[model samples]
Target: MVDQLRPNPAYIEAVLADAALSPYRTWMGLGITELECDRALVVLDIEDHHLQLRGTVAGGVMASLIDTATFWSAFVRAPADAGVANVDLRVNYLEAVPKGARRLIAEGRCLRPGRRLSYAEAYVRDERGHVVAHGMSSVLTLAGKGLAIDLPKYLEENE
Candidate 1:
């Protein structure tokens, strides 16, 4: 089944482009280096704003990275019009990211994919290749509501 889930090149390209253009992804400096049937690789260059007073990467940033990577891992198998919503997310902070680390890499893989739900896991590693955090997520797949879809004009106007 996994073998049959391979994403086409165009779909992969679209996913990467959307990730690059998303406002939140842009703000977080997230970049998608690879996207496959059930796996994804993402990177974030460390910045001052991403750190805490203790000089370590903030937990929220790590969480967001995990979530995004996990979502994409499952999304590669979803219908073009499908959207993903978080059902649950669990993260284990294994070690603090060092202050001097220049970048963080997140590798995510889908454990299972289904019509209504998907499960995925992600590991965040520092530039030194030490795992700083690990995460697992379950997502609800919503058909006919893709992440890349434009919102209604009325909704945008109201906002």
Candidate 2:
């Protein structure tokens, strides 16, 4: 049986439908291909807006991927009643994504999990499987903060 307390990877469409994630889902074409208690896989389809003046993927876009990946990795392990915040984020751009690259995939791993804080790292790769960026972040669970959707309800409904 799946653990209802944990984020459900199977119902990605339902999870992404939450209003809080609308920007990432609609604007950035971000999708969660995999999600677990301590890891996540996020993908972004390459588009014209993702490119910079040089025609390479913009650094901000890469950073956003890292941020989203790390955040989700940690969030999956956080308390169900709390909301997570990325307190610190650090990313290193390793390569420029070629214009022809179809998509970027980010793999995130939670290094440590705690009631109040969590640490996560993410690596972004181009469609060709070349590492383009690496990042790490610290996430904090804030009391009295709740997500826009009732996660437990969604999970139960979907299940």
Candidate 3:
């Protein structure tokens, strides 16, 4: 099993900031206000863009939620690097989210964190109290300085 590391305060702050600025257009501007790994809880707030054609939460949105949540699960169990890269991700959508499913919340946990990879699972539930989607994924660390400390204000504080 790969040894998990603790995230410095700055790194955590930056990740939350990244969640706000996530480049994925679907989740762009979205924010996950609360998160913890020991208990494996992931909470996120949905914005207008997450809605689908009928105003129901889009399937893609749910997928993103699962992916993001599982990422955090793995992140908390892996080396503290803000720049971990996804080696692969696969999802299975189980149900449609009703319009205004209320608030989106994802619950996920780390399955394993090996020397070279990390695996995690997450389920997306609509505010309606229905399972919207489920997913699992793996991440691969790449060549980079990686995040080790409170990210310098230069990184998180900036774009």
lDDT per model vs. reference: 0.82, 0.80, 0.62
- C-alpha RMSD by candidate, in order: 6.5, 3.0, 5.3
TM-scores, each model vs. reference: 0.87, 0.84, 0.70
Sort every candidate by lDDT, greatest first.
1, 2, 3
lDDT, candidate 3, 20-123, per-residue tens? 55466333433455555421455556667766666767777766667777666766544444355566778888877665555767887777765567788888
TM-score of 3: 0.70
Please give, for residues 57-153, the per-residue lDDT of candidate 1 as tens digits: 9999899889888988888787766778768899999999987889999998999988899899999999999999999999788888775634353
The full ranking of all candidates by TM-score, starting with the best, is 1, 2, 3
Give me the overall lDDT of model 1.
0.82
Off by over 4 Å in 3: 1-29, 38-48, 143-145, 148-159
List of clashing residue pairs for candidate 1:
none
Candidate 2, 1-159: lDDT as tens digits: 236356455544444455235665579878778777878899999999988888999999988899889988887655555668899999999988886888999999989988899999999999889999999999998876756666677657766
Task: Give per-candidate clash totals.
Answer: 0, 0, 1
Please tell me which model should have the higher TM-score, number 1 or number 2: 1
Q: What CA RMSD would candidate 3 show?
A: 5.3
